[model samples]
Target: MKNSKKLFRIMTMCLMIVMMMSVTVFAEGEATEYVPKLYSTAWALVPPVVAITLALITKEVYSSLFVGIAVGGIFYGGGNFERTITHVLNDGLIGVLSDPYNVGILIFLVILGAMVSLMNRAGGSAAFGRWAGQHIKTRVGAQITTIILGCLIFIDDYFNCLTVGSVMRPITDKHNVSRAKLAYLIDSTAAPICIIAPISSWAAAVTGFVPGEDGLSVFVQAIPFNFYALFTILMMLGLVLLKVDYGPMKLHEDNAKKGDIFTTGARPYAYNEDDGKKENTKGHVLDLLIPIFSLIVFCVIGMIYTGGFFSGESIVTAFSNADASVGLALGSFFALVVTILLYVLRKALTFKECMDCIPEGFKSMVPAIMILTFAWALKAMTDSLGAAPFVEGIMKGNAEALMNFLPAVIFLVGCFLAFATGTSWGTFGILIPIVVGVFSNDHQMMIIAISACMAGAVCGDHCSPISDTTIMASAGSQSDHVNHVSTQIPYAATVAVISCITYIIAGFTKSAAISLGFGLIAVLGTLAFIRSREKANGTYIE
Candidate 1:
C-alpha cells in the first residue's frame, strides 16, 4: 500500500540517521554524565517534531509516539544501541512512571474512570440525560452548558476535562452534538480558562515560575493581556451562538446531524456501548447529582488541604500553593469511596457490581494513560536533550534587539515550544522567567509579555496532538484522538493568529483595553466571515 511504503521509507530514514549518529558516538568515548552532542541545540526538537508530524500524517498515535521516543533515545544515547535501549526504557519510560506526581495523576484518572463507569452502570448517566433532554432543547443550549460547566470547573484543567466530559457527554449526545465538537469545547475551555483564572492550578504554576517579583500580582495584571485565552473564550461563544462550524469541524458537525456523532467511524470507547443495556432502572437524577457535587466539594477541600489551608493559610494563599497532582488524586479517591457507598446503600447496584466497575473504569482510561505515558517519556527525552535551555537561549539572545516586538516574538516562541514539547507548563517554566528578566525595569511591558507567554503556550498546547490536555479532552469526550486533533486545529489556529496580532498591539500600545477590544472584534469578525462562507457553500447548519 502507499501508506505502508511511506511508513517504511520513514522508518528507513530514521534507522539511517541512528546508524550515522552511532558512528559519530563511537569516535568520542562516553562519560558517566554523557551529554549528547546535539544537546541544547535546535536538533533537540527533532524528536517531538517527528512524532507530531507522523501522528498527523498517519492518524495513529501509539506507534508515532514510540518512534518519537526512539528518536529521542537515539539522540540522547548518541545512537549507541545499548545506551539507547537503556535510556528509552530505564531513563525514559520508567523515569516518568516512577514520578510521584505522574503516579498521582494516573491514580486520579483511574478513580475518575471508575466513578464514571459506576455512574453509567447505575443508570445515573441515563437518568440525567433523560432529565436534560426535557430541559435543554437545542444543540446550542447543550454546547453553551458544556462551556459554562468547563469554565466553572477552573480549579484544574485535568479535573475540568474529565469532570465536564463525564457530566456533559450524555447531554451533548442527546442534542446530536459531535464528539469532536465536545472534545473541542472541553479542550479549549480547560487550559484557556485555567490560564486566566487566578485561583487555578495554572495560575499557581505561572506564578511559581517568576522568582523576583510578586508572582500572583503579576499574574493578575497579565490576565487582560492574555489574548489567546480570552479570545478562545470569545471564539467558543461566537462559534456556538452564531452556529458557525468550519474546517474539519464542519464535516463532523454535518455528520453528527445525520445521527453519527463520530464522523471518523472509529469508536475508541466502544466498550461503553453496553452501558445503556446494563443501566439500573431505579436510578434517579440524584444518583448523578450527588456524586458530581461530592467530587467538586472534595476536590476543593483536597487542593486547599495540600496547600495548608488546614494549617491556617488563607484560601487565596492555599490555592496559590496547592499541589494539583496530589490534590486531585486524594480528592478523587475519597469521592470514589463515597460514590460506591451511595450506590450500595441506595440499592442502585450490588456491592459486587460496584466492585466490577473498578477494573472497567481502569480499562476505559487505558488509552489515555498509554498516550500520557508516551508523552511524558517523550518530554523526558527532550529534557535530556536540553530543549528548554535551547529555547531559553534563543529567547535571551534576541530579547534586547526586539524589545518593542518582544511580546509578539515571545508569543510565537512560546507557541512553537509548547507545540513541540506538548506542555504549556513546561513552556511557561522556560519563557516566563526570560520575559521577566528582559522587562524587569518595564513593569507594564513585563506584564504583557508574560501574558503573551501564557497565551502562546496555551495556544500551542491546544493545537499539539501530543499535549496531555488535548489527549485528556479526547478521552473525556470519548472522541477518537486523531479526529479531535484534526478537527480542532483550524479553530485553535484562528484564535492563535488573532492573539499574536493582539500581542503585537499590546507590545506597542501597552493598553489591555485597546488590545483586548481589538481582539474581541477580530474574533467576532472572523467567525462572521467564516459563517457566511459556510452558508454560501451550502454547508452551514441551521
Candidate 2:
C-alpha cells in the first residue's frame, strides 16, 4: 500500500505536467493533438516506459502495470475523465480478458500451474531434485545443466520458460543457486533459443509476417546474422563457465551460496515443496520424468494438430501455421488429464489429491496470471494508440536514409520497440514488412537487417517486465517478478549493446563469417575482461 501511494504520487505529478503541456500546445493550434491522437507519434511509447520505470524503482509490478494501462486510457480518452475510466475498463482490462486467445493463455498458465502443483505434492519434484543432485555435483554443474536443458527445449519460448523453470528450479535451489539466477537462465534461453531455431514458434512468427517469399528460408539465413540471439547464448555459456557474476546478479548469487535464494524480503509465489505427502518417500525420478515428457510430447502434438498436420500439412508447414497459445492450452489441458490418470494408476497421488492440486495449481499461478493479464491489457492500450504504426512509420521513414548502417539502426529500433511494447513478435511484425520495402527483400542487407530485427526484439523482450516470456520466467522460477526483471536487465543489456555493434559490422560486411566472428570474440572478450578485473580486484564472489 505504501509503495502504491508513492508510485501514484510520482505518476500523477508527471501526468499533470504532460497534461499542461498538451493544453498549452492545443491553444496554439500548431501542435499535434494528444487527446485522441495515438498510433503514429512518440506518445504511443509512453505507457510502457512509465510503467517499467516505476516498477524498477518501486519493486511493485501490479501497480506499475495499472499505471501504464491508465496512461494509455487517458490518451485514448482524450482528457475526458469519464471516458478514460470507460476506456480503461472496457477496452483495456476487459478487452484483453475477454479475447479468446488471451483467455487460452490464461487457461494454459493455470493448468500448467496445477500440473506443477500435482508434481510437487506427489513428491515428484523432490524425487527429481534428489536424482539430479547425485549427477549434478557442484553449483557450476547445476547452472550448466540448466543451460543445457533450456537450450534443448527450443520449440516454444512459453513452454521453455515454464517447463525449464519448474524442472530446474528445485535442482538449482538445492545447489544453492538463487531463484533470480534461475530466472535469468530460463529467460535467456527462451527467446534467444527460439529465434535461432528454425523449428520454433519464433521462427514461425517471423515467417508469418513476410508474405510472398520463402519466409522459412530467409529465417534460416538470418540465423547467422542474428547477433543478439547467438551472442546471448555465447554470453550465457561464458557467464556459467567463467564464474561471472556482476551487478545485482552478483548479490543474488552470493546470497544464494549463503542459503538465501531470494535477496529481497518478498516471495510472490506460494508453491511449497515441504507439504506432508507420503508419496515423497515413495516417488522415484520416473514420477517426474514421465509427466514432463508427456507434457512436451502432447504440446508438440497440439501445435501440429492446430496447424493441420493431421489434415495434410507437412511438419514445417504445420509448425508455421500453428496457433501457439491455443495449441499449448489445448495440449496442456490434455496433458493434465493424462498426468492425473498416470498418478492415479501409479498410486503416487490419490484421485482426491489430484483434484486438490487443480486449485493449488491455479492458486500458484495467480501472481503470474495477474501480471500477465495486466501486461496484456497494457499492450492492448499501446495498440489502441497505434504504437505499431508509429514504429512502422519510423522504420519506413529512415530505411533509405540509413542504408549502409541499416542493420544497426534496425536492430536498435527493434530493441526499443520490443522493450516499449514488450512483444518481440509484434516488434518484428511491424518492422519486417517495412524492412522488405526498404531493401525490397533484395539485397544481402535484407537478411542482415531482418536478423537484427529478430535479435533486437528478443533482447528487448528478455529485459522487459511486461514481456510474456519474462513473466513466465518469473513464474517458472517462482522468483519475485520485479527481482527477475531488475536483475536480468544488465545481463541482457550487455549482450544487446554488443549485438548492436555486431549489427553495425554485419550491415557493412554482409558476411556472416566476419560479423559473427567479431560478435563471438566480443562476447568472450567481455566476459574475460570482467573475469580478469574481478580477479585482479579480488571482488569475485567466490
Candidate 3:
C-alpha cells in the first residue's frame, strides 16, 4: 500500500513538472483560440484508458480519475501549465457542472438519498425487510425478488439503480446476499432492461439518434436482435437458478454466506452500527411501499410532462422525447415532499427528525456524487479531444469491407468506445448514424446493426467502472465502488462474449429467432458447465 501511494505521488509530480516546463517554453506567445493538437485522433482515448487502468491497478478511484483528467488536460493543452490547469478546471470540471442536465442528476441523487435515509430512520426499510423475510425464506428467494424488482423499474436506468438498491438492500442483507451481488443484480437489470424497453429513456435516446426514418419502428424491430441486453437477463436467471458464481463474484458470495457480505475491508457507504437499534416501532411496510410507488408514478408522469404530454403529445411521443435528468429531479423532489408529509402525519418521526434526514441523505450520496462529477469531467475531456469523431472515422472507414460481419464489428467498437468514455448514449450517437448510413438500403441489416450498437453500448456501460449507472449501483448497494466493478466484470464479460457471437450469427442468418435461440442455449450451457466445475471443486453453493 505504501509503495502504490508513493508511485501515484511520483507519477503526479512528474506530470506537473512536464506541464511547468511546457509553460516556460510556450509562455512567450499570446494565447489564441486554442484547438487541441490531438483532436479527433486515436490519442483522444488515452485519458480514459489511463484513468481506468490506474483505477483497476490501484484500487483507488479518486486519485486515478484525477490523473486521467490531468492526462487529458495535458493532451488538450499540449503540456502548457496554464492551459492545462484552465482546461481541466474551466472546461472539464466547471463546464460539466454548469450543464443543467448534470445539475438535475445531482439534485435527483441527493433527493433520492434523503428519501432512502428517511425510509431507514422511520423504520420503513426495517419493516419491509421484516415483511419480506416472512415471504422470502432463502438467499435465493431474496436475490430473485431483487432481480424481479429491478426488471420492473425500467423507466430509466438511474431511477432503477437507486430505487432497486434502496428497496432491496435491506432484504438482501437479511438473507446474507452480498452487497456486491446486489449491486450486480441492480446494474445488470438497469441498462440492459432499459435499452430493450420501448418506453424507456434509453429507447428514446436511440430513436432520436436516427434520422430520415421512423425511429420508434426501427427501435421496436431492433429489439429482438439486441443480444447483449436479452442475454444478460437470461444469464442472470441461469446463475440465480443454477446456484453458481465464478471469478471475483464467487469469493464475495462465499464470504457473504459466512456473514461477511463485503469480502474486502472497504465499506464506503455502510450504515451506522447502531442503525438497527434506532428503528422506530411505528414504521410499517406501507411507509416504504407508498413512497416507492409514488416515486415510480410521479417519475413517469414527470418524464412525460417534460416531453409535452400536457401540451398534447401522445404518451409514446412524450416518452420518446422526455428529458430524464429533469424529469427524475422533478419526480424525486415531489416524492421527497410526499414522504416527509407521510412520516409527520403517521407520527413515524417528528418533523425535525425528517428535516435532519435531508442533510444525512446528502452526506450518504456524497461519494457517488463526487465520483459522478469526475466521471463527467473525464467525459468532457474526451469530448473536447473529439473521441466521437475518432470513433466515427473508424466506423465509416471499415463499414463496407466488413459487410456481413459488420454487426459484430459494430458491437465491438461500441463496447470499446462506451467503455473508454463511460457513456452509452454518447456511443449510440457516434455509431448508430454510421450504421444507419452504411446499411441504409438494407433495412433488415440496418436493424440488426443498430441493435448491435445499442447492445454493445449497454454492455460497455455495464462493465465500465466510471459509468454513472455502475457508480450508482455501488452507491445503492452501499458496496465499495471498486469491489462492485471488479466482481461484476466477469459476469458481464461472459454475457458480452455470447452476445458478440450471437451478433455474428444474426448478421449471416438475418433471423432474430435463430440467433436469440442460439444465444439462450449457449448461456444455459455455459452456466451448466460452470455449475459442474464448481461441484467438482466442492465449491458449489447448493
Which one wins on TM-score?
A: 3
Candidate 3 stretches with Cα past 4 Å from truth are 1-6, 25-32, 271-274
Q: Tell me the deviation in Å of residue 194 in model 2.
A: 0.6
lDDT of 1 by residue, 347-419 (tens): 9999999999999999999999999999999999999999999988988887999987999999999999999
For residues 1-542, could you state the per-residue lDDT of candidate 3 as single tens digits?
A: 77777777788898778777777645336578667889999999999999998888778998899899989998998867777888899999999899999999999999999998898899999999889979999988998999999999999999999999999988898888999999999999999999989999998999999988899999999999999998999999888888889999999999999999999988878654346676776689999999999899999999999999999999999999899999999999999999999999999989999999899889889989999999999999999999999889888887999999999999999999999999999999999999989998999999999999999999899999899999999988889999999999999999999999998999999999999889999999999999999888888976
* lDDT, candidate 2, 1-542, per-residue tens: 58766767877788766555444332224466444665568998899998898888878899889989889877876765666667789988899899988898899899998888888878888888888978999999998999999999999998999999989987898889999999999998899999999887888899999866799999998888888888888888899989998889999998999999998988987445444353466687877888899889989999999899999999999999999988899889898998899899998889998999899888888998999999998998898888887778777777888987988888888889889889999998898888877887466888888888898899889989999999999999999999999889998989888888888887777899998888888889999999999999998876
Clashing pairs in 3: none
**Lowest lDDT 10-residue stretch of candidate 1:** 21-30
Model 3 worst lDDT window (10 residues): 24-33
Provide the RMSD of all predictions against the true structure, rounded to 1 decimal.
Answer: 1.9, 3.6, 1.4
- Candidate 2 yields a Cα-based lDDT of 0.86
